[model samples]
Target: MSSTQSTAQIAGSGEGGKAFPIPQGMSLSYWLQGVRASPLLDHRTTEQLSKSAEVVIIGSGMTGTLTAYELLTRPNPPKSIVILEAREMCSGATGRNAGHCKPDQYRGFAKYSELFGADQAKKVLEHQFKTWTRVVDYVRKENVACDLWVGDTLDVAMSKEVASQLAAVYNDYKAYGGKVDHINYISDSAEAEKVSRLKGAQALWAWKASTLYPWKLVAHLMKACLAKGLNLHTWTPVTSVSASPSIPAFWDVITPRGTISTPTVVYATNAYTSSVLPSFAKYIQPTAHMCDKVVPPRAYAGSRALQNSYNVRMPGGTSYSINPRSNTDGIILFGGNNPNQALLKAYLDADPNRLFDDSLSNFKPITDAVRDLTSTAFEGWSDDAPAAGIGPEYSWSGILGQSADALPFVGKVPDHPGQWICAGFHGHGMVHIFNCAPGLVTLIQGGTWADTGLPECLELTPERLAKINERANNVGKRVV
Candidate 1:
């Protein structure tokens, strides 16, 4: 039997699979939609490698699976490669996002320029641009059956404090000679509201983003890798890794049942990366990310579905990324700042929901807040038969790593030979992993620490790590 059971839910609905009475669409995932439309590829349960391979990668989310896929398809493939996952593909944060893909280097450009320098910030943007192109190309070439739409994005500001920030960012990018081709500032709330389908006081629009089905993306990538003969095993978690300067490098990848040893290991576990690299335990911290499904009630069927993704800064001091999904009426992916780790104790203590139902009291606040916001902001939305009218189809929480500098660490573990890491995308994995993984394959093959045009700040060093630790101290806060 497989070690990890498959779990899924309609968006926003609690366990029991009932539709939320909200205005957003259904809560089912696009991946699940695809599976329902077709067939799922076969996979392995926990399996042991009779002997060590040239490389062993842990975690099969976007980062791990993509890394494996890239390595195997490279001009010079590793002698042998193995990928192990703690759960099914896209079972983690990789499957939970809004699928907004963008080379949105601007998101972190201003922050990095302030902390690092203009050169470093520029390099980061350049790197993300490369990654974005690679992602688009891969999705097209691989013929991934996901809804991939390309266009601009909007940053809707519900309050003046946020509008000013949006304006400042827009001007700063322009001053830096950064392209804001699709970015425009609208001072009139009426226009902004109409464009974003959001009730905002003002809005900043940018033209370089796309939205797709995240679960479909993950499944397609996984299928592509499988077709390429990549070896993969699910439910095999790497609990600990042992390495030393004196001893030859070897990784002891632990699973629920057994352990596998390999010469080369890649930690693509993201939020759970610290579990393998204890040295980085203090540097890489896992923070909770959440997404909600909001359905539009039938009364507002006249409103067109949002074409682009949006970031609305709510009056309650939270920012949510809203998009229209293939299944969900509307999806809101939100990030919380400096959230208390203990706040989710109850949910963590219970059994994960197998079906969708919205009966839990503890889960009320988040969906309630989203419902209230949608009711006020969305044009002419009405509550349907569901209690909330656009009730919760499903709401879920996953872990993502925060980098001190808000960039991914995508190279060898410094001073530790034969080990590599590619984690800490900070909710920007799709924006960076395609380019990052290929570059990582080059470094591993060339056996050099050559900078691959990614931000040098991603390098794990005494100084870089120290900065990350300091940032973690203010956990739940956005580093950028």
Candidate 2:
């Protein structure tokens, strides 16, 4: 389990309400030194276009920023380009991610390969590999310091059932000519401890995983796009799009601030896509994405600490990741729909923190539960200080679209020509978008979706849109 804090009790970022307790050994100098850097994306008055551009993109996060950069720097650039954001650039999911910019080495392509086909799986793999390399290269070349890190991730299995399940899938990945070099399934508690630093654990290690500070990275990219002369605006929420066969080459996009007429439009609003279109609403579902930051004791951040990312399969149906930031201190960022379901009910009920008080009591049992389950294997781990207790520094939620068949619904909106979309990345936007955005740009400019090089499954279809709408409508308790 986990702690349940009432919305009121959950730590807020203000003065004299409830002081945040700074952890022991946490000096002002150290805190200042540890703060990550982000790129500049000015959030001020909304920008007005002297004239509508040839192409207008919505959202200013990675997806939109990356695509804008590609378009402006292409062999033949668009006549004019504009990026409209509802808030500061990178303020959405792009800034809120764990900043782990690694390929999809852990989420085995076996199941996806089986369901889609070997060729499609290979394409997905290629897309992620290229994206990973591009991100690292951009960060390095631009001299962006967002705590870029490179390390393998351990998918720890606490039970035989999980071990068996992973073993079979690991072999399947190998059979499909995929990368499995760093994956090590360990049954010995001693061996697992060496890699995970968590006692009483068994795990499968995926070697190519990495992490970074997401907000800073996105901000840097946004800044670079501006340096390239692309027009960008903030706090401009698009209300709707009027595109029909009669106006195939143009769309009248309405916003709270004003209206813009553009020949082409691209959407980078992943979770909030449905908010603009009633049909899209049935596709993307907004759910609570919860994670907590903690200052583990110095011993935990030392050389003997958990070397890489750790995803633990513990009691109940919950999955947790033990991630070590550059410094010794680490944070636990993991969850699935299962645990969230129970937490959501309790959270919706009358002030669970006052009633059940699980946040530090029953709910937060997992904090110590993992240690007790392993007998100090995660030794040195301690409860968060009042300053950075279980509460997130900036916790918020965004919607992500899910295809009925569990693939991305990319490309043009059928029946609405000249209007393109690049949302619905499931939960793997980092892995999917770096290349997907560039490819979509090409398709939008050249007027051929075939040039995207993605599988047909990723393309929009009537059946896919129907299912997307169905899921978008029934997203109640299951979402959180």
Candidate 3:
């Protein structure tokens, strides 16, 4: 449940908008800070390519790492599988995001029902729950040192009007036969405020959710894959991918280094897919987003800290997704909401190349907005909290692939065979990528959609792509 006015309500950069198609070179996030082992991360498994590989994967983000892991660990895996990254390993959305494995259980079901029917809405929501479960299970099974914490998330409504709006959606989802067994709602205002520890909490919704060190999780799996005969190249930007004229039914993946001919090409490149596959320029619109890592003030620091995660909601559909770490530092991961909505609106709609660059958020008003998170949103926050620059010590931006339909574009590419994609996850990649990657691998292995165990609506087809365009044109905006 992430909110960005620029992402939710805007027009796509369009198919012709490919001026700034690739990712920027330098980017560092809160999660990406202090990472060790530069050799394993940016090491060239083989200096020179083998001319061809059974599989070539683009983007070394969550989708890329998970897909490689699934393929390598499974029986009868591909002989040569290569992963190409535009920048450092896992330096994309997966590395920068506020790590929340919470799914949109009921909030977006109504909107989803309108887009892809109620059945798909239910399946999509269910898939997120399963994905979250998989992440938790994977961390425990692998004994990952990624600071995994299994807990509940509090969806706190700041006003009674918002509370009523949420109640209507909850009722709507339940009426449509969406699962409600795992959810618990607090309707009483006093009880809601007490449970959420927010001053003006009018209502509260609680369910199983978690947060973790996202960069650590990806890097951990990446190390395991390297040991399992995976060839990974970091900072290798793939300029383009074209059909092999000499070898029919083969793709020539052209990089600055060299071209690798392969029968299979998987695009894990979420926001930057348009760089290699121009057809996806309009379908997967890249949008720049911001997040912060804050050292909490005295009131919310140490023993008197925020216990659970929260989606502090306000009117006008804007929100702040807060992750109160269950660690010694108790550093809060704060994200969502843009202070300069008008500026972002113009940037997203007008400039194509600028949106793909996540190095800097053009909106400077975000600094003041992020610093005011605790004081403005939470209860018992000090007025004179540690003078100046203490709040929001580190704030960075990452580019997210905003899908035309709000759902991710998974499975095979529409018109191109042997070319698969699993991207455009909005900000819900943490909950969706765990499952979507394996499903994509299933399709790549000559299996049907049913064999992948994914929702039908998630499949990438010409029909769906056409519908995305139709909606953007008909509705005058791609957001809903």
Q: Pick the candidate with the highest lDDT.
A: 3
Residues 349-391 of candidate 3 have per-residue lDDT tens digits of 6755557666654255665666565676667676554666456
Q: For model 1, what is the alpha-carbon lDDT of residue 466?
A: 64
What lDDT does each candidate get?
A: 0.62, 0.59, 0.81
Per-residue lDDT of candidate 2, residues 1-480 (tens digit)? 333333222121111122221111111111222333422445532346434677888888778888888888888887777888765556566664545565766354665675567767766766777778777777788888677777676777666677667667666767777765655656676787666766666655555666777666766666666777777776566666776335556787776566777888888877656545446544454333433344445455456445677567654646665556754246433332323435554542443122112122223433333334334456545443334343223222232344344555678877877777888676568777877888888787775667876666677778766544565467532221
Better structure of 1 and 2 per lDDT: 1
Query: Which one wins by TM-score: 1 or 3?
Result: 3
Question: How do the candidates rank by TM-score, highest first?
Answer: 3, 1, 2
- Per-residue lDDT for 1-480 in model 1, tens only? 001223322122211332222111123333333454433222562245434667888877778777887777778787667777655555565665657776764656678787678777777777777777777777788777677776667767788777777677767777887765645667777887777777655765555667777677767767767776667776555556665333366766655546666778888877666556656544454554455655556554435555667666655445667665523444434333212223443443344331111122224555666666667777666545555545456555555566646788878787777888888887778788877776777777774546465567656566776666576576754363
- RMSD list, candidates in order: 7.9, 8.4, 4.2
Task: List where candidate 1 sits over 4 angstroms from the true fold.
Answer: 1-42, 45-47, 243-247, 299-303, 315-317, 326-362, 383-389, 447-451, 469-480
TM-scores for candidates 1 onward, in order: 0.80, 0.77, 0.93
Give stretches of model 2 more than 4 Å off. Answer: 1-51, 244-248, 315-317, 327-341, 345-377, 382-403, 447-450, 463-480
Better of 2 and 3 by lDDT: 3
Put the candidates in lDDT order, highest first. 3, 1, 2
- Top-TM-score candidate index: 3
